[model samples]
Target chain A: MRQINGQPVTTTNSQTRERILEAAEAVFGDNGYHDAIVDAIGRRTSLSKGGLYFHFPSKERLFFAVLDRLADRLVSKAEEAAAGDGPALDRAEQALRAVLTALSRKRRLARLLMVQGYSMGNQFERKRAEIFDRFAAVIEGRLREAVLNGEMVEADPALTARIWLGAVNELVIHWLHAGGPSPAQRADEVAVVLMGGVRAPMPVPMPAELAR
Target chain B: MRQINGQPVTTTNSQTRERILEAAEAVFGDNGYHDAIVDAIGRRTSLSKGGLYFHFPSKERLFFAVLDRLADRLVSKAEEAAAGDGPALDRAEQALRAVLTALSRKRRLARLLMVQGYSMGNQFERKRAEIFDRFAAVIEGRLREAVLNGEMVEADPALTARIWLGAVNELVIHWLHAGGPSPAQRADEVAVVLMGGVRAPMPVPMPAELAR
Candidate 1:
């Protein structure tokens, strides 16, 4: 029933809500869940405590909202890459690269999601797993396609997807711990390692050895 | 210096301490650190609060001691497997199998270490990283030997080690999530995937004359 310029009041309220979430991501990313306070997040925005609370009922709610926004962005990027036309492995690699790129740009937020998010409580822990499951499903889908096309060997796509997800998560954790480098480059290396493996072929036995 | 059954008081105390840690592992593993109480662990044994406190100054201390014991057992098993005479990949697989076997038998404890422990606080987080580092180092050392002996392709041993550690950790996490099947068998499949990779060989082109 309210209007400002050409926009309705709900639009204005939604815009404000988005800004609050943006600030929440940075505050939660920087201070972690335990240390992050609502006041700190409010300071970064133009809204009052009442306005912020109107958008998010509590700090825990705000934290989960930020995580949800992050998860949505990441999952969409990966989905786009996976749905693109290319070799199955290449497309999967691109999806992974897209994920790393997005996370690197939001490195602090990435740390908050990977390290601090799960430990908050059982609810948050399950939420984190669900987010990870989305990523794993994308990878598993691509892996299944690769196998059907004969671009990959027969293997459990679900298990392989989980393994790949874990490897990528670990790499990101280490990268964050060491401070962010060019994660795009590291993503390429990870693709190679995961697709090709690390072992060298054993030398063939000599004729004399074979006789023995 | 009271004696028990002709044993020195110190020896009896040490035995009691070990018993307390064993019970602590199950309690923390089942309840996690926050929900886990000193009294619960005490009830699992014959120790009272006073007796438990005598052996472990605090619940956190008891929790760390249990983690340390778990770490020691895992590291020793990996070390023995790595030191055995065999191709490097085989040794690494054996080491991984040993880890999976140990973890499968103590599923609750493994969850405690991998999931709940890191989020407890900075101290536990740091301790978890240190334990992971030890495993990575052993893996790195074996990888170096493999490369030198031509059993593995040349690559960054340190990075590969970390990646391997991450993959194994992820697999265990998934196994726990899926409610612990025989992880030993899964470990073999993981080894094959890690060592040989998932990419299939490219098909050779047919001759032009044959096509005609």
Candidate 2:
């Protein structure tokens, strides 16, 4: 079949590597890491197993390439979001919403990254950890800005990022796996909790005798 | 081998089932769900493949049994924590801490659950949803009490519970895989963000600085 651009796409070196990575993402998302076969990924594109091997040394490397691509998109999105001007809290929220929404859109890729992402062993795991820390740093920077502006109480930025990331991540998994609710609805609900917490004060009822 | 309590553990239907479940937990934890085999679990005790099959019927069922056992422990812990007498927020915090800590303790079990807990097809996924809602209900009850006592803001209990659960679950996964900081330290950090959010107020200048 012809490539999306309608031109004859090269299946050599870098181009082959990119196609293999894309195929790996789809295959991994569908069958998970353990169940996914490198052969299948190669079959998805024009590349033979030998051709794919020329780019990725093994299945693990191909999987990491897929994860790396996804992480790059996330990092780029975060950078763009950070550069925008707004209240720190609002900006953080916008960044999170954008990332979460994007993850939701790429439901399969997101699941592969979050759920099966760590199964790739030390090398891939370390790379994933770096990406995770980078994402956390973005949040931490915005959080520090919020602190300087008196928008929130004192706390560690790293810890705050973990909480926010954890909250959004778990909610996304639920939205994807369970057929109960829409991602948008779940994201909004979680946003409320992240922002206000469950610690809002309750109203006190007035006595009847106090009525004038 | 003889029973631990001279109860003929493998002689009865229920006891034999329990033994198989326990063995499965150990095997799954040690080898991960996908790698764990039926024979490995059976070898842990005086049960043959046929005998184990009589109880569990299949490896999948045995895996489910381990999941059910963990869910029961978690449910009981949540109940005890929620029922504990204390200030509303204090109780809530205590309950959250207890559940998160328990999850961390069962790190291998948590790993198995994450990889296969929701992958058990529609029927098992339904059961997973039920267990999830049950845990969420415990959190919702605590939140309701907090609202009543003016310890927390009035909010949608169900929604809040989902968010809190999501955050805790992700934290549990990170704690399990990374083996970095203590779970308590992580939990404390999450508590701060959940309560106060990512933003912290700016520090005010001293009176001496104002004079200057």
Candidate 3:
């Protein structure tokens, strides 16, 4: 096994990466992307600049890695809430609630998730879309079930998922960046507006006693 | 009257500004904020760099001016569609259709409104928020009547308008930048999802007559 500085290179390299990401999240979350410095992360992780660069080459890559971890955490929360035998709509709500609750607990997490990348432009926008799409896929799967179970009117699940995620994105922006009500408080209302569109259409009544 | 180039200052000043805005819109819309050259706008307007600088001072301001003009056009379109004795919900739909139809007719206009300034970051995002808020207020006005007239289930008109606008914004973005289907094609479905949420609740039953 390869050893560096009397430690296994493989294990320490991963541990160092995990450490760097944790510290980077705090730094990035505290100061935002533009204000943050590599040295600050290096100091936070007890690594030299050379060591930091050895693991992740640039600040942009490091920042996005932090975002990926955050996104992965949120996606799992959404999927876990969405899983099981519950009615799909309720599960969808649970997924929404899970995300909102998690965000509400940590303002910094919310900022990192929604606000930090505003300055980074195209790459960040694409990343935001990718993360939102990940969340949408989880919800879209549940919504497809909701439709199949006759819980909703016939509607395109893919489009509905995108729209639903968009509304949530707006709601979070209002709460976090725009000085509006917290999303947890507004979660049900958002659901009503978005979900109402899909509520099952008036069921087609079977022809009543046509034989008569 | 102050005249440097043989034209009356006040009359030509306003006309010059108007001319610059028109030419700048074409340039910025075609090449985006970063790629579009100020000199291109100057050339298109038959004005020198000094003449162009005489009106708007910087490219950022010039770009925002174009966006503001476009947003104003959209805002007025929404208000006009909403300005009738017909049902408010239909008016909202009309407003949505009007905007989407206009956008479908011109990809560049849609790009200018929804896609450009995307790379410019904070200033652009703020401008976007401002423009969206303008559209939201117009729709909110109609939705207020929609709620009062029992056209929708009880909903916060302000929030509903924001979410509705957010959905439309996302649709346009997907259509323009993300290779998604045209928003014009999905306009009705967009309406169903967002409007469904605000739909008026099932009404209270009239009390049985005590006289009976």
Candidate 4:
């Protein structure tokens, strides 16, 4: 049995996989998606390219795996938070705040997931969408709860959820790109704008054909 | 003189450079930054790579030049709209509306400027900052005028401007990524949120921290 990072590789493939992922996250975050290489990821675990491949077939697969891990963590946290005893509005805010804190601490991983996610297609994109859908589901559930609780007016919960998600993602990207303040500040601002609108929907102009 | 895009290429070096920039915008919008090439840009005007090189040494430089042109146009439009005859609030809204419209119409350029801008450093970054600063100045001026004219409450004009800019940019990215309905709806929502406060600024946090 080969010894790697003071762990016996033969004992558990799952443990080895976890280590490889952690290493991948660090490399991808530090050097960016375009610059990170498989060799670099393997070196962190004192493993060869073959060892890394045994766990993740390609960098794209590894990237998606890392993203999946983060997304799952977010979903689990949101579900757990939302299910907790609290006001609907407060629950939503708490869930989002947790997400922002997690993202802030994992700046490199967050950046990679965002900037590269949009450009990636094929298998990588499938995983990205899955993660997005998972988060969206949580938001939708919270929105439904809000509507039921009368904390928010009845509207398209899914659409509203997507809009909130978009706003949060955009704020993070700008924050990352500009090297501005912490994500907490951005999260607070986003929360304000999102929750600021009147409980009533604004009068939107309808197209002539639609009106007819 | 050699034939160039069926034109005589008689304009001054600077003017010809400007013409090439205009053409590049049209071409880049049709294609995309990574997919766009110098030859396609040359086909739009009487400028070869050699001639273009005289002005911009590389494809990336030409792309930056295009971004510069668009930035200048937006800033100039904002300046004109701000200085023109209208209510201070109306003028500020008009200027922002103009910016949002321009960004939506030039989606490719907006994406290029955003994605590539992050990857650039040193001179390119400085150039990008210079252009962004020009627009920021326009926003600040109008904000100051709004407070002076009593159209808006007194606050940090600079911070207000950045917050608004950040919102618009975030919305633009969201609109693009979602492949959704008109951006105007979301843009209007943002404008309303900024113009008014969510929860009336909490009645005691003052308006400074709440502005963002």
- CAPRI quality level assigned to candidate 3 from its DockQ score: acceptable
lDDT by residue for model 1 over B1-212, one digit each (tens)? Answer: 65558885554878888889889888877766766778888888766899899888888888888888988888998889888788775676667677767777777767876777754644565677778888888877877777777677556666777677777777777777765465666876677667664223333344443344
Model 2 residue B156 lDDT score: 62
TM-score of every candidate = 0.82, 0.78, 0.81, 0.72
lDDT of 1 at B48: 85
Per-residue lDDT of B1-212 in model 4, one digit per residue for the tens? Answer: 64557976467777787788888887765554544678888878856777677878888777777877777777877787677767676677777777777777766766655444433222343555566567767877877777787666555565456555655655565565666754555556555555653223223443444443
The full ranking of all candidates by lDDT, starting with the best, is 3, 1, 2, 4
Ranking by DockQ: 3, 1, 2, 4
> RMSD for each model, in Å, please?
6.8, 7.7, 5.3, 8.5
Instruction: List model 2 lDDT by residue over B96-209, tens digit each.
Output: 788887777766666655444433333344556667778888888887887787666556666667777777766665566567875656777677667542122225455445
Q: Residue B140 in model 1: shift from native, Å?
A: 1.2
User: Local error of candidate 1 at B50, Å?
Assistant: 4.7
Clashing pairs in 1: none
Give lDDT tens digits, candidate 3, residues B1-212: 76658985565688889999989888877666666778899899888999889898898998888898898888888889888899897898788778877887787888778656654544565787788788888888888888889898788888888787767766776666677668887787877776676767555333332222
- The DockQ of each candidate is 0.25, 0.22, 0.33, 0.11
Clashes of each: 0, 7, 6, 1
* Model 2: CA > 4 A from native: A1-10, A85-87, A118-130, A148-150, A184-189, A197-212, B1-10, B84-91, B114-130, B144-154, B185-189, B196-212
- Candidate 4: the clashing residue pairs are B4-B46
What does candidate 4's lDDT look like per residue over A1-212, in tens digits?
Answer: 87657886574889888999889878766665545778999899888999888888788878778777877777787777667777676677677777766667767767766555433322243455567667777877777787787777655565565555655565555466677776666666656556554243434344443434
Stretches of model 3 off by over 4 angstroms after superposition? A1-11, A26-49, A201-212, B1-52, B115-118, B123-125, B201-212
In CAPRI terms, model 4 is classed as incorrect
